[model samples]
Target: MTWLLVIAGAAVGAPLRYLTDRFVQARHDTAFPWGTLTANVLGSLLLGVLTGAATLGDHRLHLLIGTGLCGALTTYSTFSYETLQLVGVGARLYALINLALTLTSGLGAFSVGHAVAQAMST
Candidate 1:
């Protein structure tokens, strides 16, 4: 049952990740990897919310959304590859910017999500 929940979530998350990446990247003309950043930041926020709401005692929710969905939705490998690609192509500034923005934005989004979830639970 637990595994099934995780599988179901990943089934949705994987395609969603791909579609979202394509959608966001299509609108941008830069090598900044906006699509990857968006997906990661969104995943972090959702994980934070799930963690914050742990008191709700829904283990299935954790396994499904947190483990499966977030695991598939966020792509650290792609982020690293893109960053390295930027550096290899002499776009070091863009690489740095991507790193900085991804870190800060992901953290900020997670914090906000956690706070929101905590408040809602209370």
Candidate 2:
């Protein structure tokens, strides 16, 4: 039953990640991988919320959304690849910017999400 929940969530998250990446990437002309960054940050935010909610005794939600949805939605591999690609192509500055921005924004967004969930539970 738990596995089914995860699978169901992933079924939605994986495609959503792909579509989101494509949509955001399409609008940008730079090679900075806005699409991947956007997906990862969004996933982090959602996972944060789910995690906070889980602390309030919603383990199923955490399993379905956090472990499953976020697992598929966030692309650490792609982020790493893109960063390395930037360095390989002499876009070291962009790589650094991407790294810094993703870390700061991802953590920031997660904090915000967790706060939101906590407040909502209260």
Candidate no. 2 TM-score: 0.94
Residue 43, candidate 1: alpha-carbon lDDT: 93
Give the alpha carbon lDDT tens digit for every residue of 1-122 in model 2.
99988998898899989999999999999999999999999999998888767668667877788878999999889999999999999999999999999999999989999899899988
lDDT of 1 by residue, 1-122 (tens): 78998998899888888988999999999878999999999999999898888998578989999989998998899999999999999999999999999999989988999999999999
Location of the lowest summed lDDT over 10 successive residues in candidate 1? 50-59
**Regions more than 4 Å wrong, model 1:** none
Where's the lowest-lDDT run of ten residues in candidate 2? 50-59
Cα RMSDs of all predictions? Answer: 1.0, 1.1
